[model samples]
Target: MWLDAVDGYRHLTPESLKAAMPRCPRPVAWARALDDAIEFWGVTDIAMLLAQVGHESADLTRLVESLHYSAERLMAVWPSRFETYARASQFAGYPEKLANEVYGGRLGNIEPGDGWRFRGRGPLQLTGRYNYTAFATAIDDDAPIKTPQLVAEPIYGALSACWYFVTRVTPRASIEVATREINGGLIGLADRRRRYEQASRALEA
Candidate 1:
């Protein structure tokens, strides 16, 4: 069903993807998963899809969200809450601690460690326990809710990202809108647009 809808990348093969990005070659499995997920999610904007994955996952090299920050960095991320959360107020503290303080008890996080446990994962960088639960429900899997880290896998990561695009981003068809939805703002708008253009040309060729 999904493959039928993926007209743009219907002919996209692993060899072609490798050719497109020589610096970061993707395996056959990555190609298969990416193609299937894109097809399954019914995405038409190949450029946006490709660009998003490249930017979010660093061309699919990283799946886990790196939150490691010093107290000053943490304050920068959360100007109002740093003092509230960090007791010492010297070092911003560990990534896990910052995640817990910022993400805890919100976005569907119920338990004590829900924040760090369900931190961003996968090519799309899905974050928050609530969003993870939503993805799990959409796919009819409880594993993501129980162990959100599974979304970091290429197949699942690609699938979740596709889902997000189809549901939250496809309607707008604008990289700016998608960026705001994915990153919660226009943090990397310039880079995202650049990646989209690069992918559009590469995929077109």
Candidate 2:
């Protein structure tokens, strides 16, 4: 009954949204907020939105960026950029060191802990302090920047993912373009396209 009235996108209902992401945290609330965000933002492609959400957050399970990397993993992740750091040390603080070196003093993060504090969260992997600030400003919510960690909740994750689609994808109407915008490149092009096609079939059905 309620699903029929959800902008023709039942992907948010607990049953439906949970079907989309079985491990989705707080499924009922996530469904409501995701639907509201989609409708309020005028997002046209639920499939694309779902695809990005699926790929970026791993089916709504990971709103926070996992920076817990060993030196080997760090080297693998940032091979060309931080060869020295990758070669130097491999300890418990590897993630913190990487975060500060890579993210500190950039994207409006000026303080020491700001790197880890403002690290990527949300479905679209909203990274950096500047993006956190922008998303908070866009949604008129100060919590994302002030608290930052709250954005890692699945509800805000879905909201920010929708925000990315409305601001970045609706303008182009191309998932490829949206991919570039959200991913900064075609990192997971094939997987994202697959997810889009899969989501399209599921939503359109």
The number of the candidate with the highest TM-score is 1
- Over 1-205, each residue of candidate 1 has an lDDT whose tens digit, in order, gives 2244443446356665554444444557677777888667777876787777777777778889888776666666677776544552643547777677788988888889888998889888888988898888887778888877778876787789889878777464688888887777887788889888877677767
User: Model 1 misses residue 68 by how many Å?
Assistant: 0.6
Candidate 2: tens digits of C-alpha lDDT, residues 143-192? 77778777777556667778877777646357778888878888888878
lDDT of 1 at 33: 75
Q: What is the lDDT of residue 57 in candidate 2?
A: 78
| Residue pairs in clash, model 2 | none
Off by over 4 Å in 1: 1-11, 19-25, 84-93
**Roughly what TM-score does model 1 have, to 2 decimal places?**
0.85
Top candidate (lDDT): 1
